[model samples]
Target chain A: MALITCQNAAFAYEGNTAVSNLNFAVHRGDYLCIVGENGSGKSTLIKGLLGLKVPQSGSVWMGDGLQPNKIGYLPQQTAAQKDFPASAYEVILSGRLGTRGILPFYSRVDKKIAEKNIKRLDIGNLRGRCYRELSGGQQQRVLLARALCAAEKMLLLDEPVAGLDPVVTRELYRLIEKINHETNITVIMVSHDIHSAVKYASHILHLQNTQVFFGKTKDYVQSEVGNRFLGITRRQESGGEAGGGEGSD
Target chain B: MIDILLEMFSYTFLVRAVIVGLLVSLCAALLGVSLVLKRYSMIGDGLSHVGFGTLAVATAMNASPLTVSIPVVVMAAFMLLRISENSKIKGDAAIALISTSSLAIGVVVISITTGMNTDVCNYMFGSILAMSKSDVILSIVLAIVVLILFVIFYNKIFAVTFDETFAQATGVKTGLYNMLIAFLTAITIVLGMRMMGALLISSLIIFPALTSMRVCKKFKSVTICSACVSVLCFFSGVVISYLQATPTGASVVIVNIIAFLLFWTANSIIRRGYA
Candidate 1:
């Protein structure tokens, strides 16, 4: 069964439509990357998926015990949020808040899960360090671990590599790929990097204001929208063309 | 100096002032960390002005100032939150509008009714003998309640203060917690205004948090150090005021300023040592 289904969904902010006529399903173990232009409602769609904003029209359904609150999320960071005075361990442990369920304090199992994710992300040494003092790559790793602690089945990331160096971005992509393939966890990511989206994601959801194209990556690479987005023609099979075609879509 | 200090504590009003001052200082410090981090430190100043307005009206009506002021300031706090969130009026603008208007109302009301009496002066500038026995009891109970609630919700408050969007995405009820902080702040401002004065109570909320932030890197340490610093400053300020005939509120603010400078200098030295 599909883990989540959205049928003819629409999202709006203050009665102004941001994205409309969205129909999609997230299957178990699927890696879906959402690609779009600026103001294309990628963040609004993620808000709808996370139940942060109610659908303006139609319906969003969750199945296979996949509730909205259970999905892990890694939000785009800002300068003010980066200056928050917290240790890496505290930041990651806070992700278990939904699971704790009105317990007032974290349980031992929550600590263990936090520790496991810290080890998984290879940030055990940085756990005791302040989050604001860490490098950009380390901070992203800490946030990723926090998201991992919340994910029982799926993870949702919003522009996770927005401001990172190329080397760090590549390392993060490998880490996310490892989690998706090894743990069979579903990955839904919003990205501006079209090349990495095509390289890493199994499925693609392309949004251009009200128009959307959701399909398999290979099928998307062959479609008109994908070809225009990826800057590829019917006869071209070269990978070098994928590099500069990032922000076009 | 010791004899003067011992004799000052022997007075009932002086003892009440110290007790209430320390409790208010602790509550202010505890709530200050989140307020400073969230950039809502000015809300304390805004609410204190509202409290001053309510207190002036309450005094004119012969009503208990605490009873009238607490609910009114809490409602104003909620209103400030709504205006900042839902309307085009930004947070600082909204605070300035409401605070200055309420302060004007308070000045007009006091002038119309009391006409610059010592009673009005006590609320504006804070006298050491301003807290009554009933005020002390009320402050102790309410301050304890605020402290307990803060401790219970420490982690949630930390999460909300750090990344409100992520906290809301994880179903942490950011709105409710924001309201909780505002409500507690309202209570703290109302309680502290009696001892720290309407003009100086916000310093009680801002100074300790900022002072601790200079030296502490973690939220927990900042909170702990803030509380300790607030209480110690309040005690020394009260004693200094008693000994040197300084104004209570100004003495407390001065001591807080000195503590902040000391902490900043010491932190720089420590950082240089590590470097």
Candidate 2:
């Protein structure tokens, strides 16, 4: 059975249908990329998948013992977090709170896992560093480690590299690809960088406030909607030298 | 200084005032870190205004002010949270709305019922003599409760404060935790209102956290430092208030200001050394 199955799912925002007509099933070991324009409901769909929002129509089913809280989530950075005072390790350890119920403090196992993920991300040096003081790429890596701690099976990332520079973005994408392929952990990312989305993702779900296309990477690349998106991003890449793929979906 | 301290400690009311002030100060400082991070620092000011309004009404009716004010301030905190969360009004605007109206109501009620007097001054600026035995006992119990809950939920609260969306996605019940912070903050505000007054109570909730953040890089360190700063500042403030015969709230704020400046200087020096 698929890990997550969403059929005819529609989500509304403030009484308006933000995204609708979604149909997809995510299997184990699949890296799915959700692509869209700004306000195209890519984020809304991510939220729905994370169980943060309920569909206004149809349903989102989780199979293979996938619980909503168990999904390791890497959310976009916020302004408040910019000046927040916390060590890198402290932020990562908090991911263990996903399954921690009524436990006042982190367990020894929780600490061990956090330390392991920290080492896995090769951020052992950053363990004592303040989160707010880290560079954008470093912050993303720290956040990724945090997500990995929570995600025993699946990782859900929302715009993990929004403001990162080119080299850092490449490094992050590579790391994510490595995590997905090596560990066989399912990866679902909402991104505006359609080019990187295609390069790293095994499957793509394109949305224009609804499902535009959902299929394998090769099929999506050959599909009309895929070509149109690839053409647009290609133009954007040529148009702007500094940015990766341009704005949100 | 030692002789004066001994003499001050001799008075039963002075002892009560010191004990209650310390507890309230600790509570305010503890809640302040999350409140400041969440940009809900002004919620303290807003709730205090609501508290003043309720306190005025309670006084007019010959009712015990703490009993009357606690529930009302807590409800107002919940209302402010709901308004900001569910409505078009942003958090700051909602706070401004509730705080100003409540302050106005308090002023109007005071003028009509009792007229402008020392009592009004006491409510606005606070007094060392305001800590009655019953109020001290209640404050101690409530402060202990706040401290216990805060410690027990420390991890969950950290998760919520750091990232609400991630915490929610992880099934942390972010709403309930936010409400818990608001609830605890309201109680602390009500408990401190009598001695810190309406205008200066929020300083106790904002200064220590900010001062600690200047010198501490880790959340645990910042929290521990903030609590220490709050207790020290409150103790010194009370001493200065007693020695100088000044308003308790203003004195506490002044002490906090001094501590903040000292920490700011130390942090800059530390950074300079690193550079």
Chain A TM-scores, per candidate, are 0.92, 0.96
Q: Judged by TM-score, which candidate is best?
A: 2
Residue A227 alpha-carbon offset, candidate 1, angstroms: 2.0
Top DockQ hit: 2
Residue A61 of model 1 has an lDDT of 96
Best by lDDT: 2
For residues B1-275, what per-residue lDDT tens digits would candidate 2 score against the true structure?
99999999999988998899999999999999999998888888899989989988999888999999999999999988787676576778878988999889888988899998999889988877888888988999999999999999999999999999899899898899999999999999999988899988999999999999999999999999999999999999999999998888899999999999999999999999999
Our tally of clashes for model 2 stands at 2
- Consecutive 10-residue window with the lowest summed lDDT within model 2 chain B: B82-91
Q: Model 2: per-residue lDDT, tens digit, A89-158?
A: 8999999997789888999999999998998889999999999999999999999999999988999999
What interface RMSD do all candidates show, one decimal each? 1.1, 0.6
| Candidate 1 second chain TM | 0.97
Candidate 1 residue lDDT tens string, A7-122: 98899976899999888899999999998877898989999999999999889999999888889899999666677778888899999887876678999999999999998888
Candidate 1 deviation (Cα RMSD): 3.1
In model 2, the runs with Cα more than 4 Å from the true position are A241-249
Q: What are the candidates' C-alpha RMSDs?
A: 3.1, 1.7
